[model samples]
Target: MKAMVYRGPYKIRVEEKPEPIIEHPNDAIVKVTLAAICGSDLHLYHGMMPDTRVGMTFGHEFIGVVERVGPSVQNLQPGDRVMVPFNVYCGSCYFCARGLYANCHNVNPNATAVGGIYGYSYTCGGYDGGQAEYVRVPFADVGPARIPDWMSDEDAVLLTDAMSTGYFGAQLGDIVEGDTVVVFGAGPVGLYAARSAWLMGAGRVIVVDHLEYRLEKARTWAFAETRNFAEYDDIVVELKRSTGHLGADVAIDAVGAEADGNFLQHVTAAKLKLQGGSPIALNWAIDGVRKGGTISVMGAYGPIFSAVKFGDAMNKGLTLRMNQCPVKRQWPRLFEHIRNGYLSPSEIVTHRFPLEHIAEGYHTFSAKLDGCIKTLIVP
Candidate 1:
């Protein structure tokens, strides 16, 4: 089997690896048909995520065909097409029973904050991911759903993580009718968040980013107002100005560890490893949303202290909601949205790379080169 193995920060290579096998009674071995390099994968790629051991693969979004299944896996069998959610969890856990699959208690002995995630750092559970030719799926019946015959393979892959997470971000905002929403970062998640806001009855949506290409994507693909943070001396002030001085009713932080607005913060968190992650974008969300409004955090941050402005949030009485998305929970609504022609997840795919050229794929996405919005890995 060929897999993308991490060498170190900014380094990865395709190498031969042993094929996976059914490890648990409920496990299934999936032959990956399509996989994606999510922005969160960049945290591991750049060494922002901790416990990301060398030789560990890094991918959490994928769809595949069930090559084989354990005796207990009755929901699926050989040749069944499936889209696996990023979370690995037992469906009967306390949290899972409450619809919090991302916080399942039965997986990931490393931490209690997040459940098992494929190919993410060991901090999320040292599970090998689906970035290779085949992957072992644990608790397979609880996480994977059969890909609908009408859904394209591309859409199925995105629904596993990127699209689901984005929609979850908007759902956390609790947007009301005619409310204004501001989304920071124009990455795939941010673009989807902006688009999902409309479905939640937001009257206006604004997307912020430093790159021209991504901001352009915000305008065209997301159908939202765009602002290049690089153009404004104070983007928070600009956001307030654009929202008629009251600030946006809700704000979503989609740019996580490597946000690039404050020079010192970026250096301290991203370059120096002093903070959990750069709080530039999250701080912007705190400052840009109206007082007493809601702030939804979709960005991935390490489990460490960050110099966040907690006092202001307390004084403003803002509702702060955040968590790793329960990816499977969002699929039913997303399926309907896709079938109704409200979204075409594959349109954001800007590049594709074969399994052998995944190293180049990572470089392209990490550097934001070639107007790349999303990159897919074909095994």
Candidate 2:
């Protein structure tokens, strides 16, 4: 098998590797049909996530066909096309019993915070990802579901992470009817968050980014107002002015670790590895939303200290909610949204790369070149 092997920061290559075999009674070996490079993967690519071993693969969003299953995996079998959620967890665990699969206690040894995530890092349970030709899926009965006949492979793959997480971001916002929502970052997750805000009855949606192409996507695809943060003297003040001096009712931080508005924050966190992640976007979220409003953090941040505005949040009485999305929990509503023509997950895909060209795919997305919004890996 050929898999994308990470050598160091900003280094990855396709190399021959041993094929995966079922290791647990509830495990299933999947032949990957489609996979995606998530923005969170960039954290590992840039050496932000700790314990991301040199040889580990990085991907958490994928859909595949069950090539084989262990004896205990009764829900899936050979030839079953399935979409696996990014989270790896046992369904009967304490957290999983309450539908908090992303925090399942029975998966990761360091399960104090996040549960197992495919290909994230050893910090998230050292599981190999589906970026290669085949991936071993644990707790097969709980995490994967048969891809609906009507869903395209692209949609199925995106649903595993980006779309689901975006929807979860909006859900966490607790948006009320006619509320105004602001989503920072126009990446796939931000775009989906903006669009999902509309479906949740938000009267206005605004997307902020530094790139023209992504802001353009926000306007056209997400039907949201756009702001290029680079063009503003103070983006937070601009946001407040746009929302009539009260600021947005809800704000979602979709740009994590690498947010670039503040030069010092970006350098300290992203370049110097001094902070867990760049808190510019999240800090902006704290400063841009109205007092007593809600903030939903969909962005992935390392488990380390970050210089955030906790005092201001406390003073303003803002409700802060965040989590690694329980991906499978969002699927039922997303399925209905897709079937009803309210969402088109595949429309955000901008590039496709064969398994052999994964490095090029990573470069294109990392550099934000070629108007790249999303890239798919076909095995």
TM-scores of the candidates in the order shown: 0.98, 0.98
Put down candidate 1 lDDT per residue, 156-176, tens digits, no spaces.
Answer: 999999999999999999999
Candidate 1: misplaced stretches above 4 Å?
261-274
Q: Give the Å shift of residue 259 in candidate 1.
A: 0.8
State each model's C-alpha RMSD to the native.
1.2, 1.2
| Candidate 2 segments exceeding 4 Å error | 261-274, 304-306
Q: How far is candidate 2 from the true structure (C-alpha RMSD, Å)?
A: 1.2
lDDT of 2 by residue, 166-221 (tens): 99999999999999999999999999999999999999999999999999999999
Single out the weakest 10-residue window by summed lDDT for candidate 2: 261-270
Q: Residue 225 of candidate 2: its Cα lDDT? A: 95
The TM-score of predicted model 1 comes to: 0.98
